[model samples]
Target: MTPDTTAPTLALLLVDLQNAYFEAPALAGVRESLIERANELVRAARAAGRPVVLVRTEHARDRSTWTINMRADGEGFAFRGTEQAAYVSTLERAGAIDVVKTRDDAFHGTRLREVLSGLGVSQLLIGGVSTHSCVAETAMAAFAHDYRVAIAGEAVASENGSLAAAMLDFLTEELRQPVLDHAASLRLLQGPLDAR
Candidate 1:
């Protein structure tokens, strides 16, 4: 279903687009392209006057909780307040809500759900790293909460391309969610939101 522009308030959820995830050797193959697509989504959301949320994964340095083991050839995980935890410079931070999450699911122990609800966000546009993990989890959570969820096809990636494709397919086919390209999403948001 197309979003209703007149009453459609969208929240762009950027999942775990941190430096460590991007710099990981396991994701090297699609890192650059993924970043580009994510940036495109951000630009589109901004032009449409949608609320943009930046979610980052933060872990304590002591490794007391879940241990993040970086691949031998990969740049290991970095804790919060480190350079590797910062968002890329290409993306604009103005008017964006920065949510620091400790877990894969953005809703778990985070103020994300409340923040979106407070903003009266009826639709959610999802994009970011680890298509099969964080992005998938957050998208599903948004669905469970009865929000109209749209997954930006090119803006999501996983270490395994096949896994990402399968998850995207599930969200589109089985879940009946819209997985749109950057251009289509931009146009939908820019146009009148009332049903045509």
Candidate 2:
């Protein structure tokens, strides 16, 4: 069959692939490989002239935007103007758009949905850190917004390996989203914008 011209364009949505997410030893081991995969997708998307959104979690230093856990524990992470809030330095982000978020769901309080809409993106290829939280939340929200979503399984990492797998399962089996590997994700990125 031919491509579905009615299908909206695809964009790469990377979630919370930041310095703080990789500092933990459990996730540190996969840092380099995740970066490698993310950078590859970034490059491919850039070369293809597709949108690449680098989403990060950033909270106010005064705990103004802190979630309940942060407020209860009297602590915060990815504070504004701090290195923790920054994206991982090695990822290819020169021309990509930046979407800063304070919640697990990237679209909760951010302009992520608008940003993607402005770019004419309705299909998302996602790869990010902490599979059970930010990544999962954003993917689910995207689905709710009627965006077709896919997770690049190999390009993501999590502090809890089992939870990560379970979330992937939920995204795939229950939500009916595809959890793809690196090669499959790359093919989707490089293929026709209207193809499914």
Candidate 3:
């Protein structure tokens, strides 16, 4: 697909790859593989000098930021100051920038937009957990912001397999956001962009 913009900077945005979601009962089967794929992309991005933005979700202990489902579910998901909200050890990199968001959309109440702007980023390579939720939301927001957005399919997962598949397809077919495999995502993250 042709790029939507000519802005010079590009970044790998890893959304909500925290321990809380991985340790969930429903996501056990695919968590490790997803993390591995994400790590591959992260390593490539780091080696290539592209910024790796770790966008995570952490809510108040009182559940002030949680949706009704999250409040009712009570798995202590992404609660602030808890280990669950923390990034997986392997996925956390020293030089990566971290942004904590309280909602599904990372840019909603966070400095993500400003950070990207500061870095002159006009394209975002997105990946990570709960494909049908935060991943999709962040991708949509990024696209709405006019950033060229591509999601790393292999690097993202969801508790609901069927919904996750549908979400990816929807993002690609309906939303015009490309769902890329690990290698293609790597090339995008590591390769040079067209001269601005």
Best by lDDT: 2
Every candidate's lDDT: 0.75, 0.87, 0.83
* Global CA lDDT computed for model 1: 0.75
TM-score of 2: 0.93
Best of the two (1, 2) by lDDT: 2
TM-score of 3: 0.89
1-196, model 1: which lDDT tens digit per residue?
A: 3433453477678887777787767776777787777777777777877778999888666554343543333433557679777876665678889888876788888988777766667778888988888998888878888878888777777887788888888888877778888787666556554322
Q: What TM-score do all the candidates reach, one by one?
A: 0.83, 0.93, 0.89
Q: Rank the candidates by lDDT, best first.
A: 2, 3, 1
In model 2, how large is the Cα lDDT of residue 121?
80
Candidate 1 off by > 4 Å: 1-8, 64-76, 193-196
For model 1 the local lDDT of residue 179 reads 82
For candidate 1, which ten residues in a row score worst on lDDT?
Answer: 67-76
Candidate numbers sorted by TM-score from highest down = 2, 3, 1
Please identify which of the two predictions, 1 or 2, would achieve the higher TM-score against the true structure.
2
